[model samples]
Target: MPSVRRLRPVWAETPGTVPPPPGAPAPAAVAVQPGLDELGTPLADVTFVVVDLETTGGRAGTDAITEIGAVKVRGGEVLGEFQTLVDPGGPVPPFIQVLTGITTSMLVGAPRIEEVLPSFLEFARGAVLVAHNAPFDVGFLRAAAARCERAWPGFQVVDTVRLARRVVLRDEAPNHKLSTLAALFRAEVAPNHRALSDARATVDVLHALLGRLAPLGVTHLEDLADAADPVPSDVRRRSTLADGLPDAPGVYLFRGPREEVLYVGTSTTSLRKRVRSYFTSAEKRGRMTEMVRLAVRVDPVVCATPLEARVRELRLIAEHAPRYNRRSRAPERMPWVRLTDEAYPRLSVVRDVRSGTAHIGPFASQASAQLAVEALHETFAVRRCTRRLPLLPAAGAHACVLAELGRCGAPCTGGQDHADYGTVADQVRAAMAGDPGEVVAAHAARIRTLVAQERFEEAATVRDRLLAFARGAARTQRHAPLARCAELVAARRTDDGGWELVLVRHGRLAGTVRVDRRTDPRPVVATLRATGEHVAAPTAPATAAHPEETDLVLAWLEQPGVRLVEISGEWASPVRSAQSVRDAVAAVAVDLLLPRPPLLDDVPPARPGAGAPSAPAGPDVPAQGARRTA
Candidate 1:
């Protein structure tokens, strides 16, 4: 292997090479587990192999590399450079040939990846890897290593593109593209569409970024990875949206220019501080950055207690169906499996839950609801046929295969009369209404039978069906008790010697208050009773309220130190209900059972006029300036 030394007249001129202040983040917060960059090594002590690769195409594994260029640097000084061209084992695409100037003829005489990899690996050994859009170059290298059956060295990585986005503002540079950055930073070498020149430019960009970051206390190499994310320029400009938000526990809605809610979130402490975070790098998701960019105003709904804040957040998210809020947007779309109003009832997954019905649900999706229906069919020999059955049967009518298989009562053909079929229907209703012991027992028996016969595939399928049914029923049954209550009040002692009080009606949070230890609780309870919401009694299976809110209430009630202050309506479930059944079904861990739960359509709701939630759109970079990135 041969190494070339690229000489330069001037080393990097670091402007703010100041020392880090005490307790100041090196760049941002402390990392959980320190990587090589977080190992307290000063940036000067860290060696970086700024690398570039020109490939036959853009994709890895499918594309072959045509050339590689890398320059090793430490302490703001260039050490050595490595450059090579490799035959791609195939003709280069016409577009790539024109862009890279590496035609198929030029590559035909060069060594292949298998021959050149060893030399390059040796050159990059013991150095932190740096590249522009590191994933594209590094992904290709890792994929190459895998193809060659060689272990890709676990070297630390730094992405100059990402770093530049953080350190150099968009106003300073139009874009962080290699050529654009090279021109802005006044680099010694211009970046053409060649590997060595681009690599050389990236080294200059990296140094310039370091020079800018040094003032912000980015002294340690590890500091680069400590900050969760960088605040995009557009997002930061909207910091005024959080203005006037109070420092209190509350729900906050980010409203767009059209006054449409873009996101719903809650703050356990200060709404002002929490909302302000979205304008900074602290809010680290692309979708959120986009959300902040669109937000023109912030509406804060201040609450007395943290519990109330959380509940309000859930309600607002459901009401607004904010595109940025990924959860709690479509509570109405949650599928419920209902028993039809027929002589021999059949289970059907429905979005429009009828006023009166035997149903088990709030399943995550229609597929999951259908799985629960299948579990019922497997367990109770319930009618699986969808057609409406006549009360009087024809004399010459024939039974379907389910009747002979005993998986159904064949009520459609009069082989089983309505009276006899009603027995199985009654059992199904009982399970859905709360007591699912019989249903669970039946699934367990079938699982045992299938396992004994060595039909592992069928057994696994049955296992999933049972799990889906058991969990759904348990969720509904547990929520039903709380949902049925007319008025209920609870209290929990907070860590600050205050009491968190809540008024719940029919499983929905009606009112909440926080009373300090120094204040009298008697008056607070009276105030709550007078102002509590009037909730009409829900029809049976009883959780007419959003199941999510009911769940939140139940979890709060069951937590340690919570005490029931007052109660009006009966709040109780069957002694032996789906809860017990769920435990039993989950206990069965036979060999060959699927390691994961059955797959369901748990995807996010589709954006308006789109098939699914549209991904975040790319925003513009800053105007051209003095500093730049790779």
Candidate 2:
């Protein structure tokens, strides 16, 4: 808010030094600031108070204002001028003094902001406030008003810099800086660092910017805002690229100059409006802005249902790996914890998983998969060593430290015979194969003991592990049935009583369609099944598609109101009782316990009247029964 009088801001590009005011436009947000509402007023009738300030520093919270200068004008005629020097109650920085020529000595007897702010506010009242980068001036003014305990009048604001950028072409003006614009327009007054001279230069610049708006039919104040931030003419004409795109749910790809997909996106309501936003101010991402500049055409794939649209978008992103799309790009790299095929099977974290009944994963990262494996190791006497076990026990070989600590049965060194180790493997297999009770109960007991012993940090670690196990287990279980199915048909009611039907095969969405309200969906479902893509039988983990895709399908199937219309293969997972898992682990139970399969849910009932404290909870929870779409 400070300059020699009102022409320039001294805080130019001082990153992070000054905080923008509340509701200040995000930098990515193009032209026009918020806080100004009345744009309908004719440009000629609007009064503009072009103000500038000199401050002790860039920060509004810490800085003090030293001078204020503004010129009020309406219809190209001057109305009034407000000029003042204030006692900032502090010495000006040497750099600020050299920059603005305002010294501490000159402010010795000047009126403080407490007296100057009210007069300035009064002078600028009822006028549309104007400044080059209005946030700076408006922000400083508002801060001063707050310090003076004054209520700031909500005056509509116009930022000349933003306006100039929209009105003047890049070739016409290299930049939108006031000094540059003032020189370009040949203003009678030139900006010096002083506030009054700068404010005078801004006045000329604002008028010249307004003049450029005439041919664009932007004469009214409202027109000024609409006219702000226009894309280059070539880019503007590219708005035609959105033409012919359906006003319905679909995936849209922005093809670059070489016909390469620069971006992939979707719109559930209208592809036209969403796609058009890219060529307008609504699109603020720098990369997206550049993408629009290079885009030659928009190719759209319209889907009959929203779910189909979403699924298609994911598949397209995975297939093309478009540089502009940020998600669903390498889901195959997600980790899984599996039991290796060996004489003594044990936990292993792997990235590429085909089929395995004794596996639990699609964990978000390798670390999480490892944590889940560690949680499993903590609960069962499963072997921890990764080396292959010998066919026959080597009685003379020594066991690893893990075996001594009872964390493993030491199958590698033959401390436990194959038959005995088989028992541990079965328990580990049972937990990963969808009966999670033993893992849960054991962790719960362990967490309860840690909390009672005041080892909260250790308790929290157990909590995180348990929750990670719960997430992987729950997510995996959700995908299991859908992944196992060879073909399935399902439907959900749309708002209009119509049905949205989908065709899925081996966990990948094959096809989908929406039926009109009051129309029979039976024939439509049959047609969808007939026309659906031919899916080959899936391998274990059981999905033919990416874990992410299967997860989405499961989520849609599990949503309330969706009901299965037909099926070609198994859709139910056998319910293994939690009690069996607990009994299997009881033989190896020591102290640190775990919870049932749903790590975040299902804490065992506390012992009644035993005076035993409750178990500490793991960090998360889980729940679900596969929907009976039989």
Index of the highest-lDDT prediction:
1
Compose the digit string of candidate 2's lDDT tens values, residues 47-136.
Answer: 789988888988888898888889887777777778889899999999999999999999999998998888888888788888888888
Runs of candidate 2 with Cα error greater than 4 angstroms are 1-72, 75-238, 354-357, 445-459, 573-630
lDDT of 1 by residue, 177-267 (tens): 9888888889889988789999999998888877777667676766765421466456777898888889999999989999999999999
> Count of backbone clashes for each model?
6, 35
| Residue 522 lDDT, candidate 1, scale 0-100 | 64
Q: What root-mean-square deviation over C-alphas does model 2 reach?
A: 15.7
Model 1 lDDT-worst window of ten: 621-630
lDDT of 1: 0.76
**Candidate 1 global TM-score:** 0.61
Best by TM-score: 1
What RMSD does each model have against the real structure?
20.6, 15.7
